[model samples]
Target: MPDKTEKDQTQVPFGELLRNFVIELIVYGILIAIYFYVALRFLANPLAALFGNNLAAYAVISLGLIVVQAVFLEFVTSLLFDYLGLHRLSSRPGKH
Candidate 1:
């Protein structure tokens, strides 16, 4: 029976799914951490030295940097998925 066939399909364990999701979250967290570390460690001092002290300006600059970092992360993750051969199957050609 179709119902029996469907019922026989393998199911992912809940713990395995949770573990995968957690791992992905930790990976993304580390990426964000590296972004902030690089920003503060390498760029912040030079930027402050060049631009002078203005809290509002620094805040705006930091916000822009965060947005850029997030976009960069998305692109990097897409590349990684492709490189790892784990890119999700497409329903249509040239569509992610």
Candidate 2:
């Protein structure tokens, strides 16, 4: 005789789980592409203009700008997720 709970369970396909993971990865990749586009297109030129003819200073300034843009991108992505109703459990994984 089988247990009632066992009999009542419905099996979810592993393909669905794999597909979900893949889709999430794809979304993250798109976000990364956006980050780089914003960083280079909007950030680099102004930073270069600020430190004209100085390769070292321009590199350092651009690096700082990149960091700031990365943080800004993460915030925008989080806001987007919340707007889409996919609330994040934590900003940093495994911290909770």
Candidate 3:
């Protein structure tokens, strides 16, 4: 009774989904810890100085840094997921 597209769509098991979520959470936590350590260790003084010297520049630069951090973390996480043999779950049908 189902069409080809409907038949091709498969549901991921709840337990597997939960497990993957937990794994990703743990990995992200670890990466974030490292990122914080590096940022504070290296960037604290420079950012502070910039903030004190120029408020507008500091705001723009800070925003840029946040974007860079997000992109870097995402890329690292994707690589980590692949290396750990975990494939990202997709909502689209037949597109794992």
Candidate 4:
């Protein structure tokens, strides 16, 4: 029996890797952008109501919440995709 080695790992072409990376960035960017957009809107409405139409405070708090939510959601989503093997599968060569 032969021992498995780290060198046995398959290498992806640089061009393909760059292309796939760009695609992943586009996908994640769109999803995360939408998520934060909705989150900001949702947070702003209630803040406005609670603050008696004070737009400045509402904007500040809502922006803070949006930033936090975006970071947390993005981290969780990235981890979930990795754990589910989605990222790894996407980088593989297509079968003909």
Q: Rank the candidates by TM-score, best first.
A: 3, 1, 4, 2
Backbone clashes in each candidate structure, one number apiece? 0, 0, 0, 0
Clash-forming residue pairs, model 3: none
**Model 1 over residues 29-90: C-alpha lDDT tens digits?**
89769877986688967677646767778778879988987798779777655444334322
What would you estimate as the lDDT of candidate 1? 0.63
The candidate 3 region of ten consecutive residues with least summed lDDT is 87-96
Number of the predicted model whose lDDT against the real structure is largest: 3
Native-to-model Cα distance after best TM-score fit, residue 90 in candidate 2, in Å: 6.4
Q: Which stretches of candidate 2 lie over 4 Å from their true place?
A: 1-52, 88-96
The true-versus-predicted C-alpha distance at residue 74 of model 1, in Å, is 0.9
Predicted candidate 4 versus true structure: per-residue lDDT over 1-96, tens digit per residue:
965333323555667656666766677789778966987677666776967878788778768877987798779667756654446645555444
The whole-model lDDT of each prediction reads 0.63, 0.63, 0.76, 0.68
Using TM-score as the measure, the top candidate is 3
Q: Give the TM-score of candidate 4.
A: 0.45
Q: lDDT value for candidate 4?
A: 0.68
Tell me the spans in candidate 1 whose CA falls farther than 4 Å from its real position.
1-40, 47-52, 89-96
TM-score of each: 0.46, 0.42, 0.66, 0.45
Stretches > 4 Å off in candidate 3: 1-8, 77-89, 92-96
Overall local distance difference test of candidate 2: 0.63
**Model 2 C-alpha lDDT per residue in residues 1-96, reported as the tens digit of each score:** 944332323343557545655665678789778866975678667766777778898878778867987798788767655554344322323322
lDDT of 2 at 29: 86
